[model samples]
Structure formats: C-alpha cells, structure tokens
Target chain A: MARVATGDAFTSTQRAEIDRAIRDAETVSRLEFSVYVGRSDGETRPFAQRLHAALAAPARSVLIVVDPPARIVEVVTGGEARRVLDDEEVKLAILAMQSAFAAGDLAGGVVRGVQQLAEHARKPQLRHTD
Target chain B: MAPFHALLILFLLPAGLFLVITLLVYLPSMRHSEGYQPGQVWRGEPEWFGGPRKGVEAIDETEPAAVGSGRDGGESGRGGASGHW
Candidate 1:
C-alpha cells in the first residue's frame, strides 16, 4: 500500500492513482472517474455534490467519496454514465472496496474499485459471421 | 510587574513566534506543492493515461448498451440526492 499524507490533501501518488483510474474507466467505456476525500460536516451529500461539480464530466462521470473515520462510501454517476454502470455493478464495486477498507487498505480499495469499474465497463468483442 | 506575568510572557513569546513562522513561511508552500487549495477541484485528463484522446472518436462503441443495462436496473431513482453518511 502506498503511504498517503495524513492531512486533508491527497499525496502525489494518490492523485496519480486516481488519474489512472479515470483513464482505466475511459478505456473500458466513456464514463469518467473522479474521487473525493475529506471531512464533511454532518452529511456526505454536499461533499458528493461538490465532487460531482468538480469533475465536470459530460454527464457520464462516476464520483466516489470516502469520508474519514465514519467509513462511509458514496458513489455517484452522472445521468448518461448511470445508464452503463447500474446499481448492482456499483454495489459490487462498493462491496469490494468495503472489504479492502475493513482490512485498513485504502489504496487497495481504490485500486480494486477502479479495476472492477473497468471490468464492468468492458465490451465483448463482436463476433463476425462469414 | 508580577513574577507570573513575566513568566507567562516569556513562555508565550517563543511559542507564538514559532507558530507564526510555521504558518507564514512553511504552510503556504506545502499547500501549493500538494495541490491543497480550499474549494479547488482536481481534474483528471483521460488522454494522459493513454485512454481516448479528448475530442477524438472512441474506438469502443458498446458504451451505449452498457449504460442502457445500468438504466434497466431500476435503481436510478435512488442514485439522485442520496448521501452515504
């Protein structure tokens, strides 16, 4: 696991990983990926909204927010993106991340979630009829 | 001019100076280098990671179908305005 700075900011390595996740999602599908981490006041909804606005994807981005200590995870997909990454798929990714979080593995959770998104987004190669 | 007042000032001066120095000299540079501005958004560009270049046509054409599958899951309503914590 990579070491992240303890402050409210993400380390360079963590940012790089996030960038990679976005790329992975883009490769598998058109849906964009963005992650937000910080302390929220009372609820995580506002933070999630802020993240959604920050990413500014073309109505097809997935925003994941992890609030510290509370251990809550919020996954939000834009209108167009929601069409491809259904609730079940999002739940599966969240479950995978939850398992990693239980083990005190933040990096692992993000990595696994990104990979799952990629796999879920993959399109099977078209078969050709001669 | 009590002894306690002298002692209190003596103790506070150095500590205050140290905090001021840390905040003024060290904190800003740290935040800037780490991209830690308040209310600032970090944008991830897909092109840098060898993904589809912005403004270019995507090679993968199955995105619409995948999105359609997600839409059919019937949880679209739940997705709106739901907070995790």
Candidate 2:
C-alpha cells in the first residue's frame, strides 16, 4: 500500500488504480462509477447526491468517497446499482476497505472496494438465473 | 539485571506475541480481499491535476504537440475566465 499523503491527493499509481476500478465497474454493470475525494460537512447523504449528479451515471451508479484525513469512507449507489447491490453488500465492501485502511493499506482498500463492486455487479449465469 | 529489565521483558513478550498473531493469523484473510493490483491503467484519459477542466483538457491534448500547445494556451485562458465565476 502507498503512503497516505497529508491531503486526499492520490499517488500517480493510486490514481490509476482508482480510475481502473471505476472503469471496471462501468464495464460490469454498464453503470457509471465516480469517486470523489474531499471533506464533507460531517454528512454523507448530500455528498452522495452530489456525486451521483456529477457522474451522471444511471440511478444505479456507484459513488465512493474518501475523506482521508478524517478517515471516512462513504459508498453510495443509485437505484439501479441498488437492485444488484444492497446496503448490506455495499457495507461489506466498505468494511473490507475499512480494515485495509485501518491497517495503513490505501491501495489494498481501493483494490478490495473495486473488486467488491465488480463482484456485486456480476450477472448471474443462465443456470444460476433459473 | 534489574527490575526494569524484567518489566521490559514482560512488556516486550506480549507485544511481540500480538504482532505475531496479527501478522500470521489475521493478515492473510485481510490480504485475500485485495483483488486488483495497484498502478493498473484504465482505458480512459488520465485525470489531470487541479479540477476536471485542467485534468480533462490536459488529457485531451496529449496527442499532436502543436495542437496540444495551442489547446493548452486556450484552455488556460478559459480556465482563467471560469475562475471568475
């Protein structure tokens, strides 16, 4: 994992992984994934809405926000992303990332979060569907 | 040697044991969820520093040096104007 900078600025490598994570999410669910890193006013609901608008992904899109200095991670999903990803699923992803973050594993958190998103977005096979 | 030495040894033992448990037992399960590798590049343009305008335009102008130069100047000018908003 890369060192955490004083601010939310990601290392070049970290930024690349984040972008890939979003892109992978888009590919799997055909939904836009936007990540915002900044401080929120100790509130998550409004921040989630703003992220949802900025990405302009379908209501089913996913938004991940990290207030690094504050050690906060907020994962929000639109209606569509919700069909496949429930609150519990999103929480699990957050929990995974949270553990990594607490362990000083920023890269690990991002990779795990993205992986969780991809897994949650996975379409059931026809056999499974039936 | 001294009482302090014995106390130091007692403290160190538990600390070492905790570290061992954390590294040997807990770390593997945590490591398993780390799915993607860091530094993996994506298909889209890289995000530039500053705001989306700076990041997006810088990425858009990466090709063709001459065009990129002109676009960079134009973008900077536009960026200056937008800052006033």
Candidate 3:
C-alpha cells in the first residue's frame, strides 16, 4: 500500500507496520505491546509509566516510550509481561532500540525492539523429557 | 633553570594542558555515545525520530498500541523497566 501522511510519530504506513508488529508480538507472546513516541510531557520515565498504567491491560502490557529530542527510550512491561519478558531480556531489547535510535531509525528501532520483546516473552514449546 | 629549560616548560605546560582538556571534554562523551551504525531510514518526518509527532492511532496516550484479537487485558502492576540511550 502507498504511504499516507500521519501527523504523529510515524507515517500511516509506518504506523500500520508498527501496529502489525504489535499484533504479531501479542499473538506470539500473549502479552500486550504498546509503543508511544513523542516529546515527553515531562520526565520520560514517569510519563511512560503513566502511559503503561493507563493501558487497557496494564498488568499484561509492555509499553515502549521513545522521546527522541530528549534521547530517552523506556520499556515498561506490566506484571505478567515482566514475569515472561524479564529485565535482562528487556534490556537486550532496549539496547537494540538504543542502537537503532542512535542510528536515526525510529520506526526500525521500535520494530526491532518490539520483535525482540515478543521473542523473549514467547512461550516456549514444552519438551517431553522422560 | 636555563632559558631553554624555561621555554620548554612553558610550551609543555600549554600543550599538556590542551591534551588533558581535550581528553576530559571528549573522552566521556565518546565513550557514552552509541557506536555508529549506517543507514537507518527514519519514518514520518526528520523530527519524528526525535519522538512521537502525535500518537495518531495509539489506544490511550496514558497507555498505547494495537494488540491481538482477543482482549488480553495487559494490565499494569508496577512491573517492567525503563532506560535511555
């Protein structure tokens, strides 16, 4: 599909892809994924956390907040999300995001980060060990 | 000290100071800087990379995103982490 202008973080196409990524992440991991990009209202962490808290399923949601001008990227996962997605794993996602953000690929950074989070949060296939 | 010795000290002091200042100013920043990666196409406008332009299709600005078909209800219990780069 052709790209359309969207007066937000990403273009219509970019938003569509990001939305798709979130869909895939949720499908695989059974967790909620949210990406918020914009100039932070204030301190990024608090703003991001607040955003996370206000989600439909905050307890199972993962919020990725990116403040480009401020150069702050926060990944706040909910209770269950953290249980599955873990700190070290999320940190890995954050590092991937940090690299992409540093390289000036906001959309790509978000996409990679979301994909990483989903992979980490994915439920492992059970193995029958006798 | 000899005139030559005094001249050497004078030159050395400034040169050494310059070197130290340069190190102090640039080293930490360079260390902190994320390593260069080539070719990342930013979406939307140049400024969009800076942050969300508007949060267009976001669910709740307080929270966000598009999720799976069923309502997973990904609630918040003060879980997760945060950082910057």
TM-score of each: 0.54, 0.54, 0.61
What lDDT does candidate 3 reach at residue A102? 81
Name the docking class for model 3: incorrect
* lDDT for each candidate structure: 0.57, 0.54, 0.68
Which 10-residue window in model 1 chain B sums to the lowest lDDT? B42-51
All candidates in order of DockQ, best leading: 3, 1, 2
DockQ (CA atoms), all models: 0.06, 0.02, 0.12
Which consecutive 10 residues in model 2 chain B have the weakest lDDT in total?
A: B76-85
Return the interface RMSD of the candidates, in order shown, one decimal each: 10.2, 14.2, 10.6
True contacts kept of each: 0.09, 0.00, 0.31
Determine which window of 10 residues in candidate 3 chain A has minimal summed lDDT: A1-10
Give me the displacement of residue A115 in model 2, in angstroms. 1.4
Residue B69 miss distance in model 1 (angstroms): 21
Query: Given the true complex, what DockQ would model 3 score?
Result: 0.12
lDDT by residue (A1-130, candidate 1, tens digit) is: 4344334344456567767776777788766776555554466654454445444452667767766445677776666776666767888888888777667565557667777866776667779988
State the lDDT of candidate 2 residue by residue for A1-130, as single tens digits.
Answer: 4432332245545767777776777787665566655555445444434444344332556667655545677766655676677667777788888887777666667667767876877777657545
Candidate 2 residue lDDT tens string, B12-68 = 888988999879977654544332222322122223211234422332333333222
| Model 3: per-residue Cα lDDT over B1-85, one tens digit each | 9998898799988899999999998875454323222232223232222123344323245423332211233433344556676
Chain B TM-score (model 3 vs. true structure): 0.36
- Candidate 2 ranges with C-alpha deviation above 4 Å: A1-8, A127-130, B1-85
